[model samples]
Target chain A: MKPEELKYAKSHEWIKLGDEAVVGVSDYAQHEMGDVVFVELPKVGQKAEKEKQCAVVESVKSAFDILSPVSGTITAVNEAVAADPALLNQSPLDEGWLFKIKPENPADAETLLTWEQYQVFIKQA
Target chain B: MAEHELRRTVLNETERKAGGKMVDFHGWELPMEFTGIVKEHEAVRKSAGIFDVSHMGQVFVTGPDAFNLLQHLNANDLKKATPGKGVYSHLINEKGGLVDDIIAFCLSMDRYLVVVNAATADKDFAWIKKHSEHMSVTVENKSDEYSILAVQGPNVPLMMETFAPEALPLPRFGIVEKDIHGRHCFISRTGYTGEDGFEITCPNDIAVQLWNEMLELGKPYNIIPCGLGARDTLRLEAGYLLYGQDVDDDHSTYEANYGWVVCLDKGDFIGRNILAEQKANGVKRKLTGIVLSERGIPRQGCRIFHEGKEVGTFNSATYSPTLKKGIGMGYVTPPLKPGTLVEVEIRGRRVKGEVVRTPFHKGGAFSKVLYTGKDK
Candidate 1:
């Protein structure tokens, strides 16, 4: 189950909004991608446009693009996940968070789906 | 495809119960992975793993003219495959293109068992039958009647001691009939993963029992049920070609870098004239291995460049779990030597790489036990 405190994107990324918006893939996303072998994390101070490709997550079979959910300036990147990609599969929500984005517009979180809505959205997908 | 519409092996339910993530593989509902591809791949390299390979086809030929029929059809010299031995050969068409690559096991002086790729099973059988019209041989497709399990790794020899002791002394590519759980099965010391292992072919009735029993017996060795995902990665690491992906009807044995299997002096056979001509003149393009110097996965159809010009395209490529880098095999004209610098175009970006010798993961059983009979 997705955390009720977070909002989700249609592309499967989940964001927790605060002073700095934190982004990571959802539980369903990690499960669908199978094992994560490599993670190309976005850089700090980089521009992250809403719904734009910001990072790359590669499994043993193929690679996937991780899009930013909210337009912002990247503040922090996860060094731990960059070193060990399996962290994305093991603990995708907390330790596996990709990056921190200082949102350009905090109200953009309202445009993203809520936890309950994301549950329904994935079911329909 | 609907779940019910897909074909299944006898151990399909057993695999699902073991938490296999099922997917459609050539119309068969098989597990793409169990625990995970990297984990399963590591298990086989370090310990042991089991694979359900029942999707492969088995064709039996028997009669007075069985030997002659296969001898004429296979590009390799089948005469060397005496009874109880197997020969890996390419079935080439009259145009010198591959029909399929197969392992023909000489069961007796007048009977042979041919194992073929799953997707080319029907075509291979038809090709064989079409060639044997005048020959007195009975060709039968026994794909549905049998199930094949590949038990592979560094720990296979030790595991076989408790599981099937009779399989221990068999040499590589050797086949022996052994009794397991009151049923007879063919245990061949052969595998695609470059491991010292056995491919056990048994009737479908005993498949479930054998799978469960092998898993239970192999617990001490950390044996896990591997899936097709790991199988592909493992084979790629070993530099073994996938039939339809790495090689197909468009390629001949010489161009595919499998000329070693083509015995030109073995007398008359299908595609012999063209293959001999190619052998005499050498191929224009040859299959070669590539390893990336940097991060980034190179996938199939990725263009390969040399000296800032497009030279070839990848036929099969993957992230090597063993090497922790990008590796692939592709056809490059005027084949590049090992260590030659090149670049691969991935996602419109050129990544530097180098040509390398194949069987990329050299620490497997083939390097250690199969040749020296001692662990490194």
Candidate 2:
């Protein structure tokens, strides 16, 4: 079962919000990518637009465009993600969170897919 | 979410042998890894491995004026290539863009074989054909007519001994007509994996049989069937340049470190004058090697920074299994030395890196020096 705390994007990005939304790749994404060897994340303080490419995740073969889960200003970037990239392979939905963002519009989280909703949404794919 | 799919670039015999993970490369479906990349890579280094290169394109140039036409088309000196010998060449565009990198084999006085990158097969064929209007050479796209598989690494001579025991006596760049599993084929001791190996060319129908036979014979040496994934990492570690990544039409032979194939002394080819000028002068952007000093991978198109100033961009990269570190090749401006300190922008972070003399690691599997007492 997919996690309950995270919301998903059609582009396969996922986010978890407490004070700020922490963004990362979905479990579905990391699964399809086989092994995650590299995570190219944006830096803290960078502005990210919703539905726009924010980072790049390279697998054993090719690179994929990682989209932003919400339009916001990046507050914190997980530095550990760059050192041991295999965390995406082990827990893409959790510890692989790319960066936390202060959303431009807090309502943007409502536009994303909820836990069970994304489960059904991805099921069709 | 979409249904999980296995992308294929080219279906070789090994993928058909059982289950294999395939990936899309330049719109073509090809195998990524078979029998695991680490294991297969080690196999090619220690013993032998067969690679399905059928996805790469092949062209047959024939007619009386073939040599004349090729002299103008490629960056290599066609006259220097003796019959049955192969030479690596580049078919550049009028603007000096690389149409494709190829290994052309002079089969006879009037016939030549050209192998090209799979992604540019159609475009390369059309480009060559369109330009051939002025010459009497007949350009034929024979990619469908044949298949090529490379048996490479240290134990290749022993693995292929059943077919041609005397093949051990052949030189590094040798070619011979031999039989594999009772089928006649053309064998060239040439490769892209920086190894001592043979590239076997035979009809499509007999391709499968030949692949299986080689695997059976290679059993003792622990030869594995490798896919393009490991192939890319292997070539990169050897300090070799890939056509699409490290080079393209936007770059020149000298800039790409492929000036060796230019043969400036052989009169003039299409890009000869331009290459000569560049050699006498110097190329603008130069292809150089980079080692990631920090913990991060520097991939294709990543910006190279010199003290926070953008210098150049990376062409391609990977976490090298041999080096146990991230290494890549890329184009750079002046002032970047083999050990020059640089930074690669990974995500938004300026990851520390250093320029290194090409070939992050030695060819432990292909070169003779790496092998011990025997024919290795």
- Model 2, range B280-307, lDDT digits (tens) per residue? 9988888888999886766788889888
Q: Interface-residue RMSD per candidate? A: 1.0, 2.5
Candidate 1 lDDT over B316-361, as tens digits, reads 9989988999999999988888999999998888999999988888
Lowest-scoring 10 consecutive residues by lDDT in candidate 2 chain B? B365-374
Q: What lDDT score goes with residue B91 in model 1? A: 93
- Candidate 1 wrong stretches, greater than 4 Å: A123-125, B1-4, B363-365, B368-376
Q: What is the lDDT of residue B192 in candidate 2?
A: 73
Best by DockQ: 1
lDDT of 1 at B21: 92
Q: After superposition, how far is residue B289 of candidate 2 from its true place, in Å?
A: 1.3
Each predicted complex: what DockQ? 0.73, 0.27
Model no. 2, DockQ: 0.27
lDDT of 1 at B58: 96
Give the TM-scores of the predictions, in the order they appear: 0.95, 0.76
Residue-level lDDT of model 1, residues A41-94, one tens digit each, is 888999999988999998988889999999999999999999988899999999
Please state the Cα-based DockQ of model 1 relative to the true two-chain complex.
0.73
